[model samples]
Target: MDFPQQDPAHRTLTVVGGGVIGLTCALAAADAGWRVRVLDAGAGERASWVAGGMLGSLGEGIPGEEASLALSVDSVRRWPALVTRLDDPGVVTATDSLFVAASATDIEYLRHLADFVWADQPGTGAALQPVTGRDIRTLEPSLSSRLVGGYRAVGEWSVDNRRLLEALRATATTAGVELVSARVASLAELDDLGPDAQILLAAGLGTAALWPGADLHPAKGEILRLRRTRWSVPPPGHVVRARLHGRAVYLVPRADGVVVGATHYEAEGVADRVPQAGGVADLLADAIEVLPGLRTYELTEAAAGLRPCTADGLPLVARVDARTVVATGHGRNGIVLAPGTAERVLSILEGVEE
Candidate 1:
């Protein structure tokens, strides 16, 4: 299924994969006046489908990973402009995120992490403010009263993943980009496009099969989507990330309810997309502990997604061959890194380096 191309005279670019990363790059390329055609197998259990959609540059940062942190901070900063361009302002569900601790041990760990972020990582466009349990409750009363203390990441944002994908597809279509519902098994399949035609491989985990050097692996994660009931407590206005008993859980708000997730593990031997019973149980337990009100909500969906991970924990966004550019291995930060990936891929495609 291919859409009609309105512009035949412009330079053509073919993008493989239709996930957030591929779609985002396609949209950016089309806006740059390229005749973009995206080829995707339309798989339902993709990484983008099961994501929590938190653009957590600050909240998700690690102390030693300075390079990846810088990339995350840079990418998240581009989301505001990208959201405006998509014309779907409602896709942004939360503008801030709060990291809370449910136990005393967790509180100490949270404080150390917060201190590192606040003192060492300065001017990253995100400010970390240490808040007590009372402050967290005042900010979001829906959370559990058992929370001890945590940090409020004033700049983190969350989006409706499904909605964002739809908006990107719609806007890209309107921008004259073609969406083809077919998969390219390998780069050799696209050799007929000739030497000068540009080809971008943004196929998420599938990029490894197309290009042997993508060095991508699948990190499977399970997420639950809960629907709010009439009797349920009002959802938190800010994205809530809770640390309980040495485990981390987050509840991202939706218009209808909340998204609870996710437990990560290696997916090499496990090929199933079914949400593991143990994982789901753990997520539910942690979520209910963080926001006790979630017990009443209906579990509308439970599934697993395979996030494309790399050895170094950084996304691969470089040109591989003369006409081929690879953009995958985004790990868990694909949604957060889409804009920055698009920016860098476009620069590479246009032969411009920064």
Candidate 2:
């Protein structure tokens, strides 16, 4: 995962965590005139590495989540701009998503989602037009005949999160953000910056141990990556989501392969970051039922990561003092909200808070 080296002067900011959120924040701070260096655990198990990388929050929204949806949409809009800043446009694709229902009961849930969309966001519902089975076939010929109905979320998007993380690291390097690849015990352990230098704790779930006051916890998730085949029936296109058996599953197709996931383990008894056999079985079962072509696709990878979750499903982006900032607790939307979180942090440092 190493890249070509780049050099910069002394550090003015010390950011914890090397995930998307921390790197993006370091990049933003460097661009805003802070000589930055990122302290990273360099641990292999990070939420950004295992995320499904879907920027489609509309499909995930519910009846009482308008506020969260609004923030997520704002973050999605910031992604394209961040890509441009990285000078790498290939990291993102505006592949609007489609949500389908395979059973009669699933159709009711689709209606509920549609109702939630149209409740206040008028144009969102207009974009999410209901489609019959035939219409779905017309849009994506590979879908199975079992899908009864669905709606298209016109402006949603997805990202190759693995690539994005790489680009962020490279960009941070070029911007003079020294990356220290080691685990930091606590914020109090860091002591190199000058009196004016700032400290930002953006360590995701790692913040739970580094800054216990942050109240962060781990939400374990497992995802599967299937190698796409040219001979496959569906030909693998766009983002397809469905709840075949009351469990939510989404498939994101990329240049590398198709990512099928995920199984959420928010209750007790689910081991931290362990990929359960039952979870994998259920994910594969639901994924194959919706996209039958995936049945034959190569199972390239089965991995899991712990999302940095808070009691409330929103990231914490605020200033601790004139010289310290905190930005973590982005459970599932870490990739989507990284850029916005960076912008918010930089704004606060410049005497304005947003």
Candidate 3:
């Protein structure tokens, strides 16, 4: 994949999809002096719009997802660099994340996770501390009394995805990447842009519609945004992912509100677009069961978004051809992986192994 350098003023890169990944890629390509334009479907709803913005790779990992976990760990490392490059200090939260276990089964499951990560990843194991139920209560008094033990991935951070989108929009505009609204039903139709246009198909789930064999599907997840009174005891100061009765739920706190999510519903045979009542109900129940104070929080918003995923959860960031590249299937880690995905696309453009 050795792509020769083309003069920025002469080469055009049209990215299909205005989500986090597409916008980030536009910014990076603009920085490299390539003429860039982003085409979005103009639909307001998208996976990036509703992501919980958790940067907790250590907490999200499971046994068979080790390969994707490794990719995530690498992406997490690139967050600070992106923040610096974007020169937006307020985009990401400084608060760390906590993996909490609210019952005996949770404790055992978390213990297994701890053992796996500690043995599987020697580099970052020492910093991941095993926490007792008392330690958890001590750190966040709002936690339920029935909690068992969990572990803490110290220094892991979450982003305000809404703010990150704004920041990226501002940065991309400032970098001179043209933002346009266009629904690309056909990849070949984009050739109207120019003869040398490099079409980057970074269109989340929309990629599947453009190609019959595209290895991508949508996973619908429902999340609730709860608001607290300024005077109320604040929710957990950090991200808390709990495994209660074999179900996993996470509560991500932000200045605007606490993000309680998420219930995953896999679309079996066809695309399921709408939010399910059962999914929302389960997330709310699980979230409240772990932290009692959330019961009093105002239910500000309930929304569902579809995450583009591959069967194995690995992102597709390979060259479709010399002039086309596909980047999607990031699943739940799209926010955390956007910077690294941008890096990967740039590498492909430069004809390097991504």
Candidate 4:
């Protein structure tokens, strides 16, 4: 299906949702000389706010995740150029990520993941090097002496999501992107708009609400922020993650604070809820086990956000109708996947065959 050629002089786009995904689309469209408006319900806490912002492509590798892996890598590749264009202070930060495994089972899984990436592309997985306990300690002296072994993914990076969102919002404003604080009840409301007007459904889980049966679900993730001074030992310069009993926890250190998270719960709905004490306790305990120094850190804040999940786990960036395009279901890698998704959306809108 081909969309009508939008007027080059004044293309108007209405994006639903103000989270990272929606904001990204709005910014990209606005930068392309489109008049964009973002509509967000602004009712509850969003996932973007609570994210740890780790841009881990290899670290998130799982079987049948090839599409996601490709999207992540492409997004990382575009960071340099994208950051330069944004002029945002917190656009991105290059930091290595460590994935540690304590038990034999988890060790095998980590190795398999590392091998999968390496097998697919030799140097692609160079960042993920098999390391021993001493090597881990040499890199991050603050780690607990209990660590057995792990892999260091070197080229990984993270973005301060709060700052990125702020920057995107600011850029959108500067580009004349209008932001409306209102929950979009349905996608039908955006139906059959004029040639100059385009409707983009970029609302995370809210996209599912608008188009019932849309392949989008919410994956609840809880995160905790810790004050930097609370730690007796200095925080790790790079993000640290450990896999225990098949579950994973990550400790991300930023300039302003350290974020430790997260717990994936499929049963939870997309409601705005303060992070549970139990969740924070679990994250703290995991962080301490990975790096004992974190035990001294004081909890500054706890929050929850629902990741937009899909059946295939790949983002949906397709035109659902003549005037409507849908982009959602980014899962845990929303920040990492935003650029690639935006590029695809633009391609489809421009009638480029994908």
Candidate 5:
């Protein structure tokens, strides 16, 4: 549906999608004293519900990704205050992140990345401490002996995305944002000429169906969750990652469980369903190599979701027209980028340049 222009007299905003982006937009808009409503087709098994919730913009950034890096940095900076305002305890964890390289070339690549990041801010690269195998094991006792060297990036943190989603849902409800559970038939359904009424399309992969030729597609990611007690070994103190041949694998530990994931499949026309057995086995094998003890962990669940991806691997947060704003194409960084993205959307609605 087309959203009307922002009118000082209008109060209602109909937000499409109840995923991380949509919920965050609703909460932010409500905080700004606007009546908000959220709509979603899938209440369960959404990408936001299944994400590992790592907030590491440094680790996720690729070379020449200045825009994404800027957005991620901004979002990370806003996380502390945003979580405090939400007042949701256990939503954020301040554990540092470890990026390990199994080979000499990978270590050099990491060093180059560190150098580039440091070049942006003098003396900041000193924060990433170089580590030996001994240090790696000492830092995270669960890691295997196969790793050569790694670097610890302090201040890189993670959040429990499911819990964050729950908190946002609660806050939206408290703020009186209406929740609608149904598939949106079309964007035209949200069209309105009123200045204050806005239609925000924040659904992830679902946005593709609403806006044809948006040049968005899905990148499937499969994750496996394991029970912590099945292994006799201690858990890693921080998140563990391995720069593998083609893709990277991450081990995210939580109080309730440990998440081992994920594979980024760039195939088209794939269905959004539960993770396949082969994919789960592949992820487990990768995790087991990083932490051999994970082989003994009891498998709890396997899930897969389509991360909304764009051609340039960046997010699209702009006004498609007068009544509609597109905010999808977050890919795997939806949880990490929610706050900053919402702020930008609010600014756009208020006619402020980002």
Candidate 6:
């Protein structure tokens, strides 16, 4: 669909949601000479706040999901420039990630994933490297002595998401993007912005509430934060992902501790925001198996955040109408895909095909 060219002197955008995706897009639009305002409810508990912040384009890839994998690979490549533009180097925590397996079943799954990326998709496979148990332990000495193998995804970096959010907000403010603390219960409430104004629904789970046909549902995930104490062993030097007894878990290293996560389940038709005991238990148990020293670390936080997911696991970043754009359904890859999503939004506003 083609949009009548918008007047250059009157490009106005109102972004709903103050999370990573919303802020990232708002900043980009403002920099492009668009008058932009971000409306957020200022909720303290959000998926962006509780994310593990893994930019694992390769580690997170799966077989037969070529479209999403291709998007992730392309998005991860744009992360360096995004972070550089943010001017907050301290927000990045890890430059590499290690994927490990404890049992034979886990090893088989890991091997299958390795083959899928390395053999099936050569472009995406370049980020991955198959490694033995010794190599895994050699790289992250704090990892368990369990017998198995894994892969090392080079340049798959992670960031301090909390810091990143702050940097985005600060930078966006500096760029003249208005950050309004208000809840927009419906798209009708935004009609006061005038018909010529562009409205972007990038509110994660809240996007569906604002617009129909969004095809979005919430996937609740629980994650734990462990702070290193004097008695606790040092955190791993890299992001450590593991599959144990069919459960997927990851331990992302921090300067002072580690972030362990996560347990995924359908959150549709449910309103519970509290972290489930079983989910938290499984995350801790599996994290301990991967990094045994977590027993002595302080359990700083146990939080459940809702990821807005689409049925096919691919994000929706397209123009729904000439004055309306939708950029949600990022699922668990919102941070990894923020830069690319922003780029797509700009292209849509300019009526340029991507």
Residue-wise C-alpha lDDT for candidate 2, range 1-354, written one tens digit per residue: 111111224337788889999999999988977788898887575789888888866866776767667777777778778888888877764468888888888888888877755446645755677889898888888888998987878777888888889999999999988999888886667755556677888888777676667877677788999987776664356788886857688988777568888877673422366688998998898888878888778898998888877777778887776567789988778887887788888876665663
Please give the RMSD to the true structure for each candidate, in Å.
4.0, 5.1, 1.9, 2.1, 2.7, 1.6
lDDT of 3: 0.82
Off by over 4 Å in 6: 268-270
Better model by lDDT: candidate 2 vs candidate 4? 4
Off by over 4 Å in 4: 43-45, 121-123, 191-193, 272-274
The per-residue C-alpha lDDT of model 1 at residue 32 equals 87
lDDT accuracy of residue 308 in candidate 2: 78
Per-model C-alpha lDDT, please?
0.87, 0.78, 0.82, 0.79, 0.79, 0.86
Q: Write model 5 residue lDDT over 17-89, tens digit each, in one string.
A: 9999999999999998788889888756378988888987777867878678767877887888778878986
Clash pairs, candidate 5, are 1-187, 1-190, 1-191, 2-190, 2-191, 3-323, 5-195, 6-195, 7-195, 7-196
Q: What's the TM-score of every candidate structure?
A: 0.95, 0.91, 0.94, 0.92, 0.91, 0.95
Q: Highest TM-score: which candidate? A: 6
Per-residue alpha-carbon lDDT of model 3 for 1-354, expressed as tens digits? 456456656978999999999988899899988888998986464688888989877877788899888888888888887788778877776458888887787789888888875447646676588888899999888889888888888767888888888888888999998899888879878767655779888888888888656687778788889998765668678788888988999988788668988877676533465668898889889988888878778889888888888987899888877678888888988988888899899988877764
TM-score of structure candidate 1: 0.95
Q: Which residue pairs clash within candidate 3?
A: 1-351, 3-351
Which residue ranges in model 3 land beyond 4 Å of their true spot? 1-5, 268-271
lDDT of 4 by residue, 198-295 (tens): 88888888788787756777877788887667437776887888987677898887775578889887845666455677887788778778877666
- After TM-score superposition, the amount by which residue 329's alpha carbon in candidate 5 deviates from its true location, in angstroms, is 0.5
How many clashes would you count in candidate 5? 10
What are the per-residue Cα lDDT tens digits for candidate 6 across 1-354? 768477888989999999999999999999899999999987663689989999877766777677887787788888998888899998999999888898989989988887765456555467678888899878987888894888888888999898999999999999999999999988888778876799988888878777887988888989999999999889988899898888789999888999998888897543656898999998999899888989999999999888889998999988887678999999989999899999999988877863
